[model samples]
Target: MAADRLSALPDDLLQHILSFAPEREAAASAVLSRRWRTLWRRESALDLDIRPYMAADEGQDLRNSPSPLDALLSDAVAALAAFPRRGGGTVLKRLTLFLDLNDVDSSYDSVDDPEPVDDGRVAGLLADPAAAGLEEVLIGCEHGRMRTTTYGLPLASMACAATLRVLELESCNFEPPLSPRRAFPCLTELRLRHCFFKEGCLQAMVDAAPALTSLSLDRVSQQPPDSAFQAMPAYCWVPFRLRCLTATTLELKTYSVGAEEEDLARIGIELDMPSLRYFRYTGDAIKLSLASPAPGLSSVDLNASLRGEQSQWEPTSRMLVSFSSTRALKLHVNCMNDIIYGEEEHGGAILPTFPNLKLLELDEFFEYTSSSAALAMARLLRSCPVMSELRLNLNMTRWYRDDEPKTNDPARSPFAQSMDRFNRLASMTASSRRVSELPAVLTDDGAFTCLQTSLRKVTLQFNANELDCFQVQLAKFLVENAMVLEEMHVDDGNTFWLDHLCNKLERWRADSFRRRNLTDTARFRVHHLE
Candidate 1:
């Protein structure tokens, strides 16, 4: 009956059913019968995938085939054109094209310099009125070593559709003749990755999109570097209406530390927009200052991974990022070896205080001394008086190690000395007066009480054999202190130990009055060996 009912459905319903299949599979459905033959052609949505159709034999014989790239493009164009029209009208609503160009091998020495494929066949298909309603376009091509420069996209011939909103280009060249203005008028979201353009081409592209809300540029090259170009001015462009901006791998060979500091200061002084909210930059270390102190910004992520001997780690400028309206903050620094030498050399410490902060994640934070790091952490916690969630991924690699040799006697090993130092450091943290100043949720003792009273969930992840005395002490503290804890999610490397831990808890409940009190006041749900 279901099959009978499906057979009675209209072409639109049948086409929608077939749309779930891969593009090639969906096209194959047209061979079922005359009625289905024309149904795929009239379909409004088109997903043109050319990867599966590529043949290893054909690729191997590329040298003998006349214009391999052009031939492929022509076949794609013909396939789209051959689709049956609905009421003699084109039915293309959205189109996605993926191209994987193979590398030209040096062994094919017989082939002379090949002509670049100016394949206008696919471009011509996009210009048809029936396909004019395309709302999204994605073009991606694989990179090869061939230095075979293909012509830019024929975006100028594309008819602007009112419904179009997104345009993405990946590893493709956009030559002259087709400017951004003539390409996309109603576009709102644009992403460019590993694209090459002229000096002002990017700025012009952004200027043309009046309604653009999001922009991302990664590894975009303007011009090749020159030996004489050692220092360049720091670049800054403000999109008054942009709400999100992300830039990665942006390289400037001639920028000075002083110039970067000044540019950040200028940005802080010049731009003031209520709509701007999210900003992310990952490149060489650069100073960042907020214009009007981003009172409305919600989040900020900055990561710099610079290499080479000349790479400097100190934050040269004071970046007072004021996030009066921010609720979430994430700070990540990879290497801090260069910044630990002198207080005067280090840029002003980040003193961000979020009164209403709810979530904070700090990763790879390091300092030479535990006291300084602890004090800084205390200040940060104090700033977030109402903070509910905090995560610290600290690497204390250098703090506890003493430079002096521990023993002149051959009997004592370095391993034993290292263990002694580790115990001493653990004791210091346990007895430190500074621990009293942290938030009630983070204090060693307070952390246990909070787990018992306010904590609704607990997650413990550790390797059983790898668990040291520090981990044991922390685990015991948590179990003894959590008064209102409801559930615990644990991942112990050994299943036997996991089961033993659960059984011990159950037995303690069966024997101890304290356990009885816990059972009455809280629910202990254990998920072990996960």
Candidate 2:
């Protein structure tokens, strides 16, 4: 520039601009000149990513070794201490600390072999007086097989709780106080993932964080209730028993739900968040009692191992009734028995119509490929009177219907051995063809009538199983009835086949008329078979 515009600004403005840079870059700016050397030190936030420690030690097969994180911790503490205070007060507000034990995205080890944190880095950070002004702390510790059990939770109210507004803890043991009466007075968002807690500890934390508006617990392990606590009542040990919380959004996933095979103690749930708007759960089929219906709840996701037993399926019935006002419903079921459809004993109960539901998703976990499966899928679609979009994910080498979209990642590539064989054997001169069971979904003109459907866009992914009656009929029905249909995607699962199934589609169909009309549709794209 003609007059050095950046240097023309005041010192305060220069320091503010440097604060936006990464911590390392902020420090490096000092090498530019004497003017920038001291500007980086005035930043209010300390975002530290301590990953190089473990990255350097990778493939060494080190176990139970002293944590390399200790040095980084000391550096953070020193930085916090060094940040100058005006009028004898701290200015630190945000501290995002990510302590990764191993490289999850590019890990060579099959097992999660994490090095233990033997240093006093974490404790020093929490206890430091300079952190009194910290309002947000996103601290995560991921060890392959280690947790900070000895330290428990460094969350005493006296330490930064009064000033903390957002707290996220991962892989940390949470021990509850006798009665959490005055804790996290200003906290609003709390997330605990892969954390260990005693029976009463979770409830105690919820009771303390009265101002919480959002809460998420992923893979949270709740220990068996103590003998003294077990005798109290069933609700005492419940994982998500939030009687006092008025949070509007909640996501909870349990690690242990006692079934036949596991030796884990039985876990119960009782949710009473009247203001909850979004609810997501992933766990075994342990029954949960809803204290009241979330009138404002618009989205729900239920991932469970629903079996033939009534106990597991019964809760789903209650959830359907409770989430009647929900606009979107997603079900990720492990076991797809008739019981999951509320067929046996719970079918008689009149389930409310999902009047607001317009989008439905079936998880890839469902492997049922039959007429009954179609009916089961239609049952949900029928309940949602105005459903516009439906996404299906087929997990078992075909027909994938799910609540969430699968990303384009090599790790998630669906390249199976069967696909390889199908590719090599498949050609314009077909050798062997196997037909799949035809599902008479539309034959019964009662519950599911595609002619009167409100579907606008449909995306289906399935393994090309002979492209038989079921697949053809389903495709034809969608092209005809979906008057408002915008786009249709038919994906074939043959990721890395020596010979592609798509290349042999013309030969396999045989009938020229069928082949010509089959691909013809409104905004249709048969995804290339990889």
Q: In terms of TM-score, which candidate is strongest?
A: 2
Give one digit per residue, the lDDT tens place, for model 1 in 78-99: 6565644355465565666766
lDDT of 2 by residue, 263-351 (tens): 22233567888888888888765555568877788788877665455444344544466677887878776533332456555555334
Question: Residue 9, candidate 2: how far off, in angstroms?
Answer: 10
> Largest lDDT belongs to which candidate?
2
Worst 10 residues of 1 by lDDT: 247-256
TM-score of each: 0.61, 0.71
Name the lDDT of candidate 1: 0.47
Q: Give each model's whole-structure lDDT.
A: 0.47, 0.59
Clashing pairs in 1: 41-84, 230-254, 231-254, 232-254, 232-255, 268-291, 452-482, 452-483, 452-484
Report lDDT (Cα) of residue 515, candidate 2. Answer: 49
